[model samples]
Target: MARGFRLIFATSLLLMLLGICNGSTIGICYGRNADDLPTPEKAVELIKNLNINSVRIYDSNIQVLKAFANTGIELMIGIPNSDLLPFSQFQTNADTWLKNNILPYYPATKITYITVGAEVTEAPTNVSAMVVPAMTNVYTALRKAGLHRKIKVSTTHSLGVLSRSYPPSAGAFNSRHAGFLKPLLEFLAEKQSPFLVNTYPYYAYRDSSSNVSLDYALFESSSEVIDPNTGLLYTNMLDAQIDSIYFALMGLNFKTIKIMVTETGWPSKGSPKETAATPENAQTYNTNLIRHVINNTGTPAKPGEELDVYIFSLFNENRKPGLDSERNWGLYYPDQTSVYNIDFSGKGTVDVNTGGNLTTVNGTSWCIASPTASEKDLRNGLDWACGSGNVDCSPIQPSQPCFQPDSLVSHASYAFNSYYQQNGATDIACSFGGTGVNERFQPQVLIVYS
Candidate 1:
């Protein structure tokens, strides 16, 4: 019995060590704006098969809530803009909403967040006024039910709320919207909920494609744009956009408030004149995005911080209003076929063929912190790899062979590569909580067998 207990303990410890290097956390937005969609149960099954563990819905659909019960998928449910006024004016309405939409589904459904209204700033003036109040009422109602700490209450906003975004360091909210935003920010800060924003770099690139390089927006840029004021170098547009929000928050004295991307994606197809919108671009954007987020590479302004992100959608909403791009942002089609291949786990390279087949890539690779990785993240990763992962650290120790010109980046590289090689050289193994890694082939290297 003593020997058996020791074996079990050893196995559990090994599993825990391997689990520390698990893949990134990513979520998808489930928008039901069209007919011909699958039932909620089918949707939930599809989500699980894709290995995604988080989901956001546009409204509190009871069908979805009940279907998702016991699935262990974290959800961020929404309250439609139309219900904002009533929910704000009366606490009873908020209480009734909880009883109907939340209380029955609590614990079973794993609902983690409640968004009062999505893009409330885009609504009318009177409607915008109700957003904060509705959020407060919902929060109060949750407290009344003893679930306030378990679930968070907040709202989502669009990048349109920013009056300026260029240079990133100078970002600020539009003065015209400040009246509504100030109170909203205060509420979110008080509740310790993230400031959710619907950010789409596709729209920004499309609007100013002449100025914004296509490679930059797609996260494939080799060149960088340097911000004059902060001396920060931006390699991708997404990071620049996120940092702009960070700067805006800092300007408002809410520097501690976290930001979560509630919606972001590229369309797989678009109408004529939308040349940049193609399957190749969509696949590239989302693939690189998965890699970036999974690597935990924070924005240039705030390195190493892990930001929660949700891909725009699960299925294309055929009836969604606006340009054709509006209806084509899904990762999968209505028939549950992948629009393009994507590896949400960030474990391996996935090639999306024109014929809808995905192929795995194998090659020589190196592991190291990303150029923009935060110093703090590197130190933490270093500690985990050498201390707990049991990777040999002598080479990076004082006066060791690889210790010449010793630095965090240099030492981390040695440890990261050691762990990567020990773990079958998989991409997921290279991710040290967003410190970052690059995998490439080195044809010049030679191998000899005895």
Candidate 2:
């Protein structure tokens, strides 16, 4: 193991002068659909213990808003879709709603954004028409309160709003959503607010063909994918998805508006069919996700950008209807015990109990190129691994023990594994920009004949 280094984050004067230091600002979604959740006060304590200073709630619940007061935690509060029509048609409704839920808590509770509707595109009945007007009314209400400059109004959309996302450069919103999107984009651009999106690479990985791998979705890919059209390199699915949104917005000529990940997570457990949903994968996905966001380089399409990201949930909700995975995305169980340990601080491995004794699971893990990848891809991966990848190739050279009977595939596998092991044998290490994969097989014993 490489010797670990402790990182203390502090903003320097020079950086502030240059620009906003978009550094390490990861938030969590505080969903309360379950009956067994801790009280708002207790949940606040738990969140504080995790050192997460930002939060997003589905509604501006009074108790929650009150509990969060003076905590200095930045909040992104929502107005339920059910209230949109009333808030849209009547300016009085928007004012009254904000007066009741927001005015009393402002400056103390630190409410930063008011998301007018969440994924209204997926609502049971079409409420799309209510979104823009409600946002406008909400802005007016804030403007009336003299808080409009402090608070921004926007709506959340699922990836379904995009008609295409492959290659990322070709990303475009569905024609059916055009009417709703144009005004929304205009509003966001006018307000200098972000385009909120709920991107779940878990779904993309689960539903995709053989092209996308679990490592790719989890930000553990050592392999970076090159978008042919955009000429950008994507290291993981989340960035690809985010860049797709950027491309989609650019297609409409809305270039200045920022993007925020309203929700993104992997479930910790699932039914038999959801094989990818497990505690280890969940921990890996989120742990790496925190590191990725904290690295603060932003997506390939938008470099050096610092943006906020909210992990899907705080606690599992038994009441959420759908597959078991829907209810298992939480970092914590209802009782507040973690399903698996993760450091939001972005400093350690998934299992951070360094003071405790270690137990090794019985198996040998090897990183190799995926058999599913094309031979040309493997060759390309090999060339990169031996070159810029910094892998030693002497073992596969002529007269070496590993040389005879060797083919391009075999040499490539050896090089990929060598690089993977050298880099601590992580999922990211094995990825030759998304081409290499890991394989587990029994150790082989070479026999010699004299």
C-alpha lDDT (0 to 100) for residue 28 of candidate 2: 99
Q: How many residue pairs collide in each prediction? A: 2, 7
Q: Write the per-residue lDDT of candidate 1 for residues 1-450, one digit (tens) a residue.
A: 676555543332221222212223579999999897899999999999987888999899899999999999999999999899899999999999899888988899999999999887787645888899999999999999999888989899899889999989999899988889989989988777889998888988999998898899999999999999988899999998999999999898786577889999899888898988998999999898888886555577755444678998899999998889989999888889999998887642322232532222334466766657889999999999887775646545564335533567767776786687666568888999988576574332121111
Q: Give the alpha-carbon lDDT of every model.
A: 0.80, 0.80
lDDT of 2: 0.80
Candidate 1: where is the Cα deviation over 4 Å? 1-24, 124-126, 347-450
Expressed as tens digits, the lDDT of each residue in 267-370 for candidate 2 is 99887888899999999999999988865556776553556899989999999999999999999998999989999887511122225432112235667666
Q: Where is model 2 more than 4 Å wrong at Cα?
A: 1-13, 16-20, 347-450
Which residue pairs collide, candidate 2? Answer: 220-428, 222-428, 223-431, 223-432, 223-433, 223-434, 224-433
